[model samples]
Target: MATNQNFIGGFQVNRHLLIAGAALTGAGALIGLTGTVIVGAALASAGRGWVRQLDTPPSELATRKLHQARAASLAGLEAWRTGTDGSPN
Candidate 1:
């Protein structure tokens, strides 16, 4: 099934339904039909998909790698400060 990668108000949605709703809304405007606009809005709203899981905790190796990255980042920052600003902390 096709799904939207972009978030709509912090939640994902059905891209197809959203596009259909937009088309319908544009058609409604052109034809001057309030019912069409309402239907379009309903379709667009029905497309919304609520977020369930944001992220999962890293595994052991992944956690180790994350720590390594953090250490490297700090070391690089310290080196830059010492060399450029002559400040060591």
Candidate 2:
């Protein structure tokens, strides 16, 4: 869907987190370490949260508009990526 393509922000943060969590979770299970499992679960939860924030509708975090320069830069980058003239993207 076009919505999927439009709502983009996080590129790698969520993925590395998820991979680390899954690996840790499996290792913890093999080693019978409850604490390791807890940490891994926490990381996985954080990764999923990141996914929800990045991929959901309105695709923006609470602080997305906090910095004018950063926002403008991101808008510019998106405009270039989409091959536009940066018309209020």
Whose TM-score is greatest here? Answer: 1
Per-residue alpha-carbon lDDT of candidate 1 for residues 24-82, written as tens digits (9 for 90 to 100): 99987878777788899887766542222225334655898989999989988997987
lDDT of each: 0.74, 0.71
Model 1 residue runs over 4 Å out of place are 6-10, 33-89
**Residue 46 in candidate 1 has what lDDT?**
66
lDDT score, candidate 2, position 45:
99
Candidate 2 local lDDT, 21-54, one digit each (tens): 9999999787888777889999999988877776
State in Å the error of residue 62, model 2. Answer: 25
RMSD of 2: 25.0
Give the root-mean-square deviation of each candidate in angstroms. 21.2, 25.0
Top candidate on lDDT is 1
